[model samples]
Target: MSASPGAYRAPGAGLRALQLLGIVWTLPNTLVGCVLGVAGLAAGAHMHLRVRDLAIVFHRWPWGPGGALTLGNVILHTGDTLDSACMTYAHRAGHGEEAPIVLADHERAHVYQYMVLGPLFLPLYLLCGGVSVRNRFERAADRYACEGRSWWPW
Candidate 1:
């Protein structure tokens, strides 16, 4: 899952900060699979209504073997944060437009969203309780990025 355009921070609680290189959310992660789920939520992490409102705060990659942290993070939820805290996926090539640029687009959007709507509408674009990972919001982001940019990974 790579970062797309329409994805926004989800609402929930206790955001878990994650790293893409070492903490890859993958299969073979069974009963011992971090319990609460994989890579999204971590200890001492909580969504700040203020922070989440100000930023999408995506932290978890919640998808596939080689999860796109930048793309995937936008769809993750922890109470109110989109993710514990935004982090990039490990595979640079998978990131499509070079990791840094991909990250810049994805993370910068959080800032833009904050400025445009003041984080009040974060959940309006998110899929809560009713769905799991890779729901409407993520799909929307994919659709958005699929515009003219061939570099985006759906």
Candidate 2:
């Protein structure tokens, strides 16, 4: 079957690993989630992913207002949501919710890294401390954005 546009597909190979890890790691904790889940995102993702109601996934990270990782998106804690934007409008700006501005620009840099660095970026990017990673990637994206590539809309 053909894929839809930006429907969020995880490549088959990646999906299998994610599923295996989820079953192994999450099955134990499922019961307690009957209580108010720490983050509704976890329950929601698990449900959608479990039944194949959604596409496969591999990585997801959340950014704080000042750019910090949300425990919900970290694999060791909440498992990966795989490219989730887990964004918020908490910090209203002149243009309103800055989450889109932050997330889109950030992820676009990731794409740019893939283009320029050609696969080495993720590994090297992960080596840095969390704060460094956030700053560096965002800056890389911003630099790319400033280049007037005319590819990214904004």
Q: Which candidate comes out best when scored by TM-score? A: 2
Q: How accurate is candidate 1 locally (lDDT)?
A: 0.32
> How many angstroms is residue 57 displaced in model 1 relative to the true structure, after the best TM-score fit?
11
Backbone clash total for model 1 is 14
Runs off by more than 4 Å, candidate 1: 1-101, 128-154
- Output the worst ten-in-a-row residue range by lDDT, candidate 1: 21-30
TM-score, prediction 1:
0.24
The residue-by-residue lDDT of candidate 1 on 23-48, one tens digit each, is 23321221222333334445433322
**Candidate 2 off by > 4 Å:** 1-42, 46-102, 115-119, 127-129, 133-135, 144-154
Q: How many backbone clashes does candidate 2 have?
A: 1
C-alpha root-mean-square deviation, each candidate: 14.3, 10.8
For each candidate, what is the lDDT?
0.32, 0.35
